[model samples]
Each structure stands twice: as structure tokens, then as C-alpha cells.
Target chain A: MTINSKIQNINCCDHIARRVGDIAPSGIRKFFDLLASMDGVISLGIGEPDYPTPYHIREAAISSIENGYTMYTPNSGIPELRQELSKHLKNTYNLDYADSQILITVGVSEAMDLAARALVNPGDEVLIPDPCYVSYSPCVVLAGGVPVMIPTCEEERFEISAEKIEPLITEKTKALLIGYPANPTGTIMPREKLEEIVKLANQHGLIIISDEIYSRLVYDCEHTCIATLPGAYENTVFLGGFSKAYAMTGWRIGYAVGPASIIAAMTKIHQYTIMSVPTMSQVAAVEALRNGETSAAEMVADYNRRRLVMVKGLCDIGLSCFKPQGAFYAFPSIKNTGMTSEDFAHNLLMEEKVAVVPGNAFGRCGEGYVRCCYATSLKELYEALERMERFLKKRGASQAATFQV
Target chain B: MLNKILRLLEDDGRLTPEQIATMLGTETSQVKELITQAEKDGLILKYKAVVNWDKIAEEQVWAIIEVRVTPQMKAGFDAIAERIYKFPEARTVMLVSGTYDLAIIVTARNMHEVASFVTHRLAPIEGVQGTTTHFLLKRYKEDGVVLDDKNKGMRQKVVL
Candidate 1:
């Protein structure tokens, strides 16, 4: 019997699961598509690094593949990776986590998904700060949970104080998801503020899913790993990965360390969904853990230099950018242009061929700003800054605001 | 701070004090002062570009010469090395510890000029004992930069 390839009678979209339908598609994708058709555009919109994976890490993967280590290991991860990562957390933060408590996922992205799916029940509310990484709230929504966003702004340094969170907490609030060296804002939560959040989490019996993917990217500041805080270890699902720190985004490796029950639950979901991360990537991660600090430090230094230029350049162009403490992005206030964030991003891309992400794509509070990643080479960054300055001046010439240039 | 400034300038000698100060998050005056001190102390000798002369449509030939030098009584190889380096044709000269006592790279308009310099000027020096010259063929890289490299566009114009 011939298969009927055409089922024109039904629309496949209608039958999509309710939870899947609830999640909105990433808004930046359309912006990127429009950008794809253009030429000679200098982009500060990429979230990943311009640097390729360090040579030694790539060699490690090459050797691993040559040795025919292609088969899957345990569902959690290869034991060596888990052990190295465990020792890493201990040495870095003094947080004691045995290898059993760490589960290596595809990336921090997958770890976030696994954490949300494992913990959230129907109608459970996950308290996430607004202007967070775009996936946090959607992952919760996909897990049949409601996401309660506590809006944060530049006045607070975009920090989520427990006082603001306290008013949003209900009995249904099951977890507090936070990422520092946060996306868009680059706000690294201070230890005192983290302590307050830990206290709040304990009092409410809430789980804290902390994404510290940018933990190593802090400029001139020590990162406070929340799990090391008093009473936070038991409640925090600490997410970390090599993507940001080691210039290893393409390697697709990250880890989640937490209390036994939460880790076991996350592993349970992970085993069924993704049996294990790629063995070669895991080997690369092992190399990254064993010998990657010096390399990571060098990359961080390079990014720090670019960060200085980027912040100063944005301010020079009269965009009023905040001095991002960590991460590769600079979120600058674009409200003075009398254009919405989307309009500013689109018009800038169209008129001047400089691509920046509309900040509101991250969350509601992200409006009136735009996220421009500074991980590109210094030459490209300089050229992009010049183009942006010209774009702003051309606009300013038409409007009431006159630029310094 | 001095080393950081040196590194920035060494990478791209054209970077202005204001630009380096902006990149390092230091004051322009501090960078200028540090640069002045560095120059006065002879810590930074020269600011020059590493050019791939092959790309310039100009005739240039380079030779790597291994010179076995006779050490002087008091100054050892230093006096001889300096004497050889003082020649305007000696592009790079060093007293290297190896089979050869002195290693020098001499650049001239062509093979004839390099041969003449070696036989006439270099070999005739007091401490110069034996010299073996190897003509340079091509330059794949120069000064920590790959020459004539095509742009490898691995990254998308935009990414999540």
C-alpha cells in the first residue's frame, strides 16, 4: 500500500501539546534571519566567543576519537569528568560535592531544562528574575509550571533582592532560578544579596537553580558560588559549563551539582531524555578541567580588555551603557532615542549594518535597552563602534538630541 | 602596568596611548607617563611594523647565517657579536648557544648583495672564524602572525 504523504485535512500545529504551544519562539531568531540576508554587517549580537576552542582541548577530543572512545558511558556522565568537575567545585568554592552529585548534561542549557522538568509539578511557580537568560522562564513553562518574573532594573544593578522576591512568593512557588554574570545585564550578584536570597529560599523551603555558567568571567571580582553559602547547598542546583569560560560552546558540555535527591531526579530525567553527553565532548571537558585554568584565565583577560573598550565605546556613542561586571554583553539604555528596543535594533541593523539584540527579547524589564555582545575581535568591535556612532549621529541629527561627534 | 602597555603596543604598534588606556581601563596620562619612562629606560627600543615584503611587489632577499666566532680574551663572544651586529645589513644578530656561536639574519636586495656582505664585511671581522649561510625561501608566518592568510569565517553574523 502506498503511503499517503499528504494529510492536508489536518493542521499539525493545532495538535501541538499545550505546554509546547505555551512557549514562545525566541524573538531574536527573526532578527538574525533579517541579518542573514544582509552583507557587511558588523554584529555585536553573538553570545558565543569568537575564539575557537583551545588547541589542547580540541587535541584531547581528537585523541579520544582516535582511541575509539565513541560508546556511551553511564547516564550521568563519564566518571572521570564527574570526578574532575567535583574536585573543581571543591577547589574553587570549597563546596563539597562527591562525583555522584554531579550530572553532566549537553550544556548548561540542557541542565536548565532538566532541572525545571525534574522539579516542577503542575502549576508550580518558579520565581525567575526578569532580564534573565531567555531560556529560564520558557523551560519552566514547558515543565508545566508558571514563571513569576520579578522585574529588575539598572537602579538595582539589575539584582533580584529577596525583598522583591518575598512579595511574589506563594505556596505554589517551588523554586527560584537565578543566573549571575547574567545575560544582557552582566550583573554578578553580590555575596550579601546572595545570602539574603539563600535565607529566603530556606525559609520558604524553595529550591534554587543557580546558573553560574559565567562564573569564571567576572572582571576584577571574586565570584560567590551560592552553594557555599550557609543553608544554600541543600537547596541550590548549581549549573556550570565550559561553554563561556573555556571558549567551548561547540563542545556542548556542562554539569549540574546539587543535593542527592535533586541530582538523582535530574539524572532520572536526563537518562530517559539524553542517555549521556557525547563521549568525545566529555573527554574534552576532562581536559578542560585538568589543564584549562590557564587558558581560561587568558581568555578572560582578553575579554576584559574588550569589555573596557566596549563599555567606553558605547558610552562614547551616547548609548549610556552600564559597566557590565561580567559576561560578554553590554546592555545599554536606548530609551533616549524615542524608539522601542525592537525598533532601535532593527533600524540600526537596517540603516548602519550593525546588529544588536533588542533587550526586551530577554524579558519585559529588558525594554528600552539592547544587548551588544563584545566577544568579537577588538578590530571588529572598533569598527562596529564607529558604525554605531555614525548611526546614532545620523538619527540624532534628525531628532532633538545632538551627539558629541 | 608597563608590561601590559608593552604587550598592547607589541601586538599593534599603531595603538595610541589613549586607545591603550581605554582598553586597559587606565588613565591616558598614566599610559603616556609609563610609555615615556619605558622609552627613557631603553626598555622599549623601537616601534616597527612586521611587513610581508613579498606582498609589496618589491625585491627582497634574506639569509640566515650561522657564524662560528672566536671569543675574545676578556669580552668573550659579546664583543664579536656586537661588531657583527653593528653592520647595517645584519637585520637580526644574536649570540646563540648551539653549534654556531653567533646567529644572524641578513636581508638585502638580492642574493648578490647578501653574498658580498658576508664575504666582504662579515667574514673579514677579527673574531669571525667560519660562516655558513642559508638563503631564506619563503615566509609562512612573521612576528607571530600568519602571512597571506584568508579570512576563515567560522562564526555566524548573529547567534543566540
Candidate 2:
């Protein structure tokens, strides 16, 4: 063998950090990277809201930085910010917590990481719904936990049953991770379902971690937190963030609310690991929670409008879809096109210059689905939707022709 | 009966087996049975519902792989080809009619994956010669359709 080949072999054979190396070999960023380089592409690939951070919230960040509020606050986060977050949770979801029970992390994204790390012991089993948020299972794996996925069908509006979840539970199962106003599917959990799940968690002694980052973006109905149900606040960790509601995705601010003990554990990790969230970000988030209500409401209203338009537009174009109740996403079934989610997405981007993330990227349950984020502008949505229509019709017509010949 | 049913479903695209059955003076169950038989016979390759792509978010990628084999080694080209085709990254492997003997299509997240497949997975096999890898730059036709702008909104809105 050549020296180069020898070096390559040596590197391949050497043991690396086990957890980092085992990360599932796919993610949302991969598609975004492709979308970035492609010319004339209109992307609904990444779940970023098109709206800017509201004026008042941006101003708060600016004011904080200008006033030299640049130093780290507390490891758990700024007291006022956490207090505001507590109030926001109680007011919105009827979930009560003090600042001591809330840990202000970078975002709900970070809250997920913290929850996974804090609760997942090596080889502990974590149950996640398939067609899930792309990050959940990987985070579980990163924490040395095994993820058992339950497929949530499109016909059921992608809701996971307590019954479906019950079968997957075992002695090794330590936690149940649920993301409502879910990422790709846009399926929001109804209160009854949330209550049932909370009951299951309680019955089985499973820690329930609820990622409610998209809670504020519900279109068809109000979001209900699992933590709001009786007996849940003690065991459930509620993840809320400023990204979706406040259009502050790039700002990277979120919080987790739970029992004092779990909050303390996460806070200890944050103290050593991240020190504190950015000072200006915490200030901005505080303003977002307290003073940015009108702005968030207005933006959410717009997303709801776009949500309906895209759902209607997609179904009009012959794609099978359920109206998303929450989140700025529409998960549609692509099983009819005789292509895998990956194939459909690749063809769409390549042929139409419209980018989407494939369903399978989320999990195996996403096999015949694709997640289209309607988080773009109205013009972009209409244009991309039209392009998808054209792609499908043309494919349909040609297939028909081939059969006839 | 099966041939007629397959022909109708394939040509019309939207004809349900029930409709075909009515036209052919047979029961829907019989029509369904014929379609199933056609699929078993490989005459009807796939049954797919039409879907609009923009409704969901899906990530996609495409790559090409090249393989070199030790021509007269103990394990010949056939063995090397089998090994290359076994990787999940290898989507479709064909003994192509070209200057290169084998053509492989792979899909993955980014260049690093394609590179690793080439370096760690493809190159190290004992009888392998050399391989060429290409990230798909563009696709003019995928699944036999040119993704053009005109076809958008072809389906009328049906209330669900």
C-alpha cells in the first residue's frame, strides 16, 4: 500500500470519541448547504421564519449592548429574564414555575441538549416519535442514549398515541421526548393527547421533556403544554425559545422550566459548560417575553396565513397533506410519486430550484414524506408552490404517457 | 383481464380499479387482483399516487462513484463490484457500457461523506485499483421529468 493509503487506513482504524462519532449520518444543515450553493433556488428547507426580529426586541438587545450589559449574568441566566420566562410560561400554558425552576439556555435547541445530557444515562432508552424533529434522536444518541422511534402516521395527523408509546417502554426506557408544534410535520398535540402522554410518563416513571419552541406558532388551535397537566410539572421539562415566536432564530435564546432539582442539575451543567447565555440575548429575550407581545402575535398571524395558503396550495397541486395545526411547516405525503422523500426533494431542487428537507431526514417514519417550511415570504411561497405543482404534473403526465406507450 | 386492468391503470393514471372493473364488466376485487398479479409479473412496475413536492421539507443529494479493480487478482472485478455495491451509500450500481466498467450513484449530506466513502470504504478493498467520485452538479431530468415552472398549480383545489 502507498504511504497515503497507509495513513488513511491508520486514521480510519483508530478509535475516536464514541459519542461524537456515532451521530446519525444525516441532518438539516446538509440540505441547506446544498441550497446555499445552488443558483436561483427558493428554499423552504430550513425552518427559519422569514420575518425579522421585532423592532422592540432588537432595540432591547441593542440597548443592552450599548449600556455595557455585555458581562455574563448568572449561570442559570439573568434573574429578570428567567422571571419573565416564568411569567410567560404560566400565562400562556398555565404552567407555574419560578426562576429557580427555569434555566435560560441558548435556545430550545440548547434546552434539548441539556435535557438529553441531564437525564440520559449510557444505554438508557429514549422514546421519540418518528417524523420527529431532526435534532431529537441525535441529541439522544449524543448523550449515549438509545432512541426508540414510534411511527406517527399522516392519516392520524401525526399524533403519537399513549397506546403507541406504551408498547415501546421498557426498564431501560428513561425518558419520553416530545416536540409539539413539531418541526417537519407541524402536528400540534392536543391537550387530551398531552394529558394522556403525561399520564403515561407518570405511570411508567419516565421523565417527559417537552420541546415547545413552536408553541406560539399554532394555526388551527392553541398549544397546550404537557407541563400544564396535573403531576407533570414535577417530571416534565418544558423547552421554550424566542426563535420561532419572536423571529429571533439567529439570536439563539431559549429556556427550560421543570422541577427545582432538574433545573438545578441543568444549571450546574450550564454553569460549567456554557457559563451563561449571551447577556444581550437574555435582555432581548426578556423584552421579547414582556414587551414584544404585539410583534409576536402579528408575526404568528402572518405565519398562520401562510400556513393555510401553502397547505391549500399543496393539496391543490395533487400532493396529499394534512393541514398543519402549528409551526411554520407542512408535512405532505409523497408516496404517490414513486420516489423516496430524498428522491422527491433532490428532483425538486434540481429540476425546479425549490429546496425542501426530505421526511426520512427526520426518521424512518418520514420515509414517504417531505417537510416544507412555509416560513418564507408570500411571494416566495407562491412561487415555490407553483414550481412544485409544475414538477408533479409534468412527472404525472410523462408517467401516464409511458404507460400508454 | 389482468393485462387489460394494468393497461387502463397505467394509461389513465387516475382510473381506480373499480372504474376499470366497471368498464371491463368485472368486479372491483377481480380488477384489483389483476393489478396485483401484474405487479407480481413485473409488468406493472410501481403504483404511486401523485404528490406535490413543495408541501413538505425533504433534503436530497446525489453523487457518482468510480471503482478500480485489480484486473487479474485472486478475487476478480466481480468480487470488487459486489463489495462496492454493498455500502448503503451506493444507491445504484451498474456494470455500465463506458470507458469505466462500473457506475455508482450515492446520496449523502456533504462532500465529507462522499470523500469518506471513497477513501475509507472504496479505496481500501484489497483488489481495488482506483476510483473517481463526482458530486452531482445539476440534474436536468430526475425521475423522467424536467422540473419546469409551467406545471405548478396543475391540480385544482379539492377540499379535504
Best by TM-score: 1
All candidates: TM-score: 0.95, 0.68
Q: Per-residue lDDT of A1-405 in model 2, one digit per residue for the tens?
A: 699787777765247777777674565555556766767778787677776688888898899989988997989888888787777776777777876788989888888898899999999999999988878988899889999998889878889989999999999999999898888888888788778888998999999998988888886467787877888888988888888888898788988888888888888888888999999999988888888889888778667657766776677677778888888888877888889898898889889998888888888888898888887766688799889988998887212111100
Clash counts for all predictions: 0, 17
Question: RMSD of each candidate?
Answer: 2.6, 25.0
Top-scoring candidate (DockQ) = 1
Question: Candidate 2: where are CA atoms >4 Å away?
Answer: A1-15, A27-32, A397-405, B1-160
Scoring model 1 with DockQ, what do you get? 0.75
